[model samples]
Target: MLNRRHIRVKVMQSLYANLGGESEDFSKDQKFLMQSIYSMYDLYILLISIFIEVRNKGIDQIGKQKQKHLATKEDKNPNTKFVNNEILKFMGDNELILEKIKQQETIDWDLDSEYIDIIFKAIVSSNAYKSYMKTRMSNFQQDKEFITTVFREVIAPNDKLYDYIEDKNLTWLDDLPTINTTILKLLQKLRPNPTKTYLLPELYRDEDDLKFATDLFTKTLLNQNELNEEIKHKTINWDSERLASIDLVLIQMAICELKHFPSIPVKVTINEYLEIAKEYSTPKSSNFINGILDKLVKEYEADGKLNKVGRGLL
Candidate 1:
């Protein structure tokens, strides 16, 4: 599911792309924003579906091994531990996940199944898988733990999988971290007998998050000149041309939230943008953004311009 910081990052990416004169149509940019965010869900399903595919691959390998004319006793009766993983089986047949997967347009692992083979090989050869397969006995807890361990160690970090995802959709590169973390946490907390709908979380936490993403993108873009002026005033000592484009966009977004969103605390907005800058911008970007935002917040506080509401909002 999407979080606010991730939403902010999506909006920042959209703004960054659109601000460079790539498109003038506001609706198009907004459409791109929503589509890009929704694409995260597609990526989620795609990545999560890797488990099912890898398990199937294991099953097929076992079948082929049995079909061989000179099959060894081990191949004839191969260890099916990974193939019978309860967590993977649950995900494979979950109605909600199947429905979502059916609806996905951007993710077709069928075409790029080499990635599945890659993940399957990595998982089977891993220490976790070897240790798990050493025993024919496994409880649901052990099964879940094995899946989580391989996911965290193998599938999630595979360079080939990462490259395939990036090549599939550039936006996915940004969404990858959050989606991978979400999948990891979901696996970590998966119950022995989970419901059909357990894995299918709503993309936005609530409608408020959706509205916040919409409003943040719209207000920042529409009020760009004003936001630029506010930032310009704070950066009188710094050269405008030398400022990172991402830092400027982040500052503008923070200022937009400060002035336009009364319910969001000033401190929260500042911290969120600063954190984003640390991840996405120059090495000194967070410090630069923090300094400018700190000065602006103090000025806004004195002039009664922040208008932050609720207790402890200031």
Candidate 2:
């Protein structure tokens, strides 16, 4: 679920934290970086668990309606299609997911049942849910579509839910977009019957990615003096007022990749930081960082220091 860019963002975040005066210990900062990366997976688990919790609530609602003293015909025979959705059922029953959540030892719905209830109410009231249950069909594909639609439309954009999540863990606000996309992509690719036990997302793409986060964070921290010299020589009278903290962090990471990481192409490293700056930095940050990086890359090449290997590497 996490790509190289996401890992880059994690490194950038760790670098910012290190430079933020929050902690001065490099080893502690490295541990924080690893935990932060794992937190993304934890957030993903918490979110996908929402569908299962809401589905359970939906089933409880049907049961309660049936036991009512003055139950109407509609109440007595509530549509179970949404509650009995196969995809949701699978997710709810999947041992892999169950064990993962158990390991995390968190279920936000338990603490905030009202949030799940609110989301359920929104789902049933939605045109998508109404149309889904209007027809008495419940195939795997239809079930998948309805659950995905509810998540896409109701659960993800829900203000109360968002506030609840943000309050639970502040970093979740950053992890939200990635977690939402991960859930949707996993939902999209789910087959009716899978050969494996579950098509779960791996925390790290590979061991190398796991190492990349630590390496990037540590390298940038250790080489701060050298990187500062590089930026200082380029920018006259540069300080906190002139450069956004995030833009400065991004540039440092880019410089680290260029000088320390040999296999990475110069263009790829520059483009990655530029994109990150555009999103996480100021309006003019992309162009500003781009200009500084352009000058630095030229200098590195001229000094025979930016000796990048690989076919496409510059």
Candidate 3:
């Protein structure tokens, strides 16, 4: 399911595509966004699949090496040690992940397979692995480092992968780093912090509900009669079709959040979209969206139509 971060990423992608010359074809951008959003889930599955692939590759490599010659005391082969000790153990311990990957057939074979291969190769070829080997030789340690290294070195470098990942995933990329520095900071944050609890069940459930709610909000906002050419003409000075199109779409999305997602505090919705506007629209887009949302929120509040739940939601 889509999360706030995922929504942000989708908005960013759509904005990029729009600004990159897909403005005349909103449907194309919409389809691309939708596909990107849906692909996030698939990306996770593909990652697990790739992990297994790497494990298998390691096993094969070890078998071949073992068939050729045994390790000597004078000449320590790091690659053989890596395969026999670290990789094989990881594969054995992570049977559940392996099972999940095996049970599923990739929906987008090209994207999934190619992405996995790229990530796997990147991990095996990274400086992190070399650094890790200098300090530690345990398979468990190597596996941990490998996962982190791939995310850091490989996955982060490829913007195209993010597009594929966004298409597969429903949520969780919105707040992620757009730059390498931010990503490193994030990776540091995701370190096995002791305070973190295993709340996968709750997280998954919330994600599902949010996805449904977001879809509903999008549909309702698009269907609103108030968001018409008349409203655009009155609210915005842009007479150009391209500018107007982007403005109208953003305004509609913001309005949808204001009306449909009551628990999402009005200010948060406004702020989120304002940030999005700055990245997606004209330089003055943040101000423009801010003004419109502010006006609309006041109007909705005055009409007693702001039916939000929970404390501090207003």
Model 2: CA > 4 A from native: 20-25, 195-199
Model 1, 15-76: lDDT tens digits are 98877432235798899899999999889999878887888898899999999999999989
Report every candidate's CA lDDT: 0.88, 0.83, 0.55
lDDT assessment of candidate 2: 0.83
- How well does candidate 1 score on lDDT at residue 241? 77
Ranked candidates, highest lDDT first: 1, 2, 3
Per-residue lDDT for 202 in model 2?
85
Q: Name the better of 1 and 2 by lDDT.
A: 1
- lDDT digits (tens) for residues 213-291 of candidate 2: 7888888888777787788788868776678888888988899999999999999999999889888988999998998
Those runs of model 1 whose alpha carbons end farther than 4 Å from true positions after fitting are: 20-25, 237-239
Candidate 3 lDDT, 140-160, residue by residue in tens: 445555555666767666666
What TM-score against the true fold does each predicted structure earn?
A: 0.95, 0.94, 0.64
Which candidate has the highest TM-score of all?
1
lDDT of 3: 0.55
> Measured by TM-score, how close is model 2 to the native structure?
0.94
